[model samples]
Target: MAEVDLSVQRYSAEVIAHRHAHHQLVLPVEGALSLSVGGRELRAAGLSGVLVPGEARHAFAAPDPNRFLVIDVPLAAAESLGAAPWIERAAGGPIALDGAAALLVRAAAVELDAGGSAALRRQWAGLLVLTLAERAARAPGREPAKLGRALRYIEEHAHEPLTVAEVAARAELSPGHLHHLFRAVLGTTVQERVAELRLARATELLSRTDLGIAEIALRCGYADQSCLTRSLRRRHGVTPAALRRAARAARPAGPGRGGG
Candidate 1:
């Protein structure tokens, strides 16, 4: 798969159409921006912007000098993201990114400009997508019951032993039924979702604690360190040791801390 390109660009007061054959996410950091897609105009404030799919016939207008984090992802890559459409729908209107999204985008732009390795860039992109998905889920209507149940179960059991059958039981459905619901509603299987949750928890542990890899793996419900390393490398393109080192370097200067 082609890697997603992330960069920052300054835009003046002009109408512009990007002809790149990739999905673009324009997140304004300073001034407001107006976007027109299929003759539908959507205005976003400083903290929000628009998502334009490749060949989607879109144009942007900024009233003043503005800075935006331009995320260029292949169309296939965007579609592979099961939550991308939800983000597109949310982008139809101004997206008010709270502190977390703002922080993540800022970090992403910094990482991009610093000429960090591709692995670093991809990690930040994943964080950006996750933050966007969180915002989309909070948009308006209630989430589907099964989806909500699944998410809740994952959250509660992320650091414990978990299985699709156990989660299905929590949702009051058979495992097969849960699998179908997850595929239809979330565009992924229950096992995939559980793996994602477990990985996310592992990421937090790697970043926030000095726990040994084996301990972290066991805490995150992995059978052993090798299993955690394999899954983490596949998902983040880096080994657990590298992740720990990166986190330690990125962490603020402080004295040694004890406990998780």
Candidate 2:
């Protein structure tokens, strides 16, 4: 099995041209950095990032204070990430991490700093890679207009009680057609996608807020606290209370800043 090396680093005023043996994903957390790669100049700031293939020639510069989360994925693991694992340009592109990805990054960071068993760290890294791979594979830069609209609708409205028919209507497509569209584009069903969005919302609430379980459940489109508990355990092998505990424990003391 391949491995992932994860770290957060800050740099300033560096002019270096180098190639790595492992594929690299550089996510800018704070400030900005410019990379000249493959005869193209890419600048990443905030949640933007760039993926560099192994052995690619690249030079980078961060003129001011910049923080970035870097992940190096082994060749075998990169190959398993679908099509092309290396993304030439990710600045303001669909390959960029959204809010959901940001949440995962924070969770992964906590896991890395937990000083737990190696297996736990590896699991977190693996999951992080899997999510990036999935997002990359979607290639949202090339998404069809209809599918894009549908996805946006789900993201914005997952908190409400929703159904495939309602979502399909909002997307201006029939329920059956929307199902096909989701399966063809996202490799999942409409219902599954909605469930993912809802669960993601629930996870965010659980980890970041002090809301009660029942209120969180209602806000996440679940009927009640029991429903949320069952769903969380079924999918994450943890109850809402347990997840909250882990999340609160993982939180850093005082304000902190880092790249995604």
Candidate 3:
């Protein structure tokens, strides 16, 4: 049986090009990337996605540090799925992921980072492909314009102390309406999304930069270093120090520069 692989991946500043026999989906949770798929230029950011059909050559480069929930769907698996995969359903370009679909991808990234089981991730991969594709097909006006603004607001201000009310205010919605929308559309609460963004940034900085753990914590909106450490321990099962140590061990020692 063909298997689905799900993982959180990062790309360097270098533009790397490759092709595979299977389809791939790149869901951006953080920074942007310039992607070239079959000579079509696309931007992977602001809760957007890039769909690479089987054997379609693609190249991507990140201008800053980034994180993406990458799904590798084998050709046989795509062909075998009950529903046609997104690549088959859509025109094969940037997938217009709605607020909920983007949140789902973010949630899956959290699970993958925390060593979620392969069986569980495979389940998520299928849902993600379907949701993104379905959402992409919906009439553009049906998508709440405020939701996109809300998500972009959260991304821009995630580093500062935030509140649901503040985010709702930015999105021009009442707190109650914001909560309702988040639950009904995104299947998550605002608090969960805030924490997810904070932790994701914390992890990205931990793994990719030479910054101190305490500073990384401050930058990610944690109250302090211990707050950050406890959150990481609770969610990711590791401390910032341990995460950085692991990251360092995985790479060759050399001159280091900070990445966004």
Overall local distance difference test of candidate 3: 0.73
Between candidates 1 and 2, which one is better according to lDDT? 2
Give Cα-based local distance difference scores for all models.
0.65, 0.66, 0.73
Provide the RMSD of all predictions against the true structure, rounded to 1 decimal: 14.1, 9.3, 7.4
Cand. 1 TM to true fold: 0.48
The sequence of per-residue lDDT tens digits that candidate 2 reaches over residues 78-164 is 556542333333322223455566667767666655664667655655666677666545534434455655765776677787789
Candidate 3 lDDT, tens digit per residue, 123-192?
9988886666554333234335566567667767888978999999988889998787766656677788
Pairs that collide in candidate 2 are 29-259
Which residue ranges in model 3 land beyond 4 Å of their true spot? Answer: 1-12, 15-25, 28-60, 63-127, 133-143, 252-260
Clashes of each: 0, 1, 0
Once fitted onto the true fold, the runs of candidate 2 whose alpha carbons sit more than 4 angstroms away are 1-143
Please identify which of the two predictions, 1 or 3, would achieve the higher TM-score against the true structure: 3
The CA lDDT at 162 in model 2 is 77
Which candidate achieves the best lDDT against the true structure? Answer: 3
Ranking by lDDT: 3, 2, 1
- TM, every model: 0.48, 0.52, 0.58
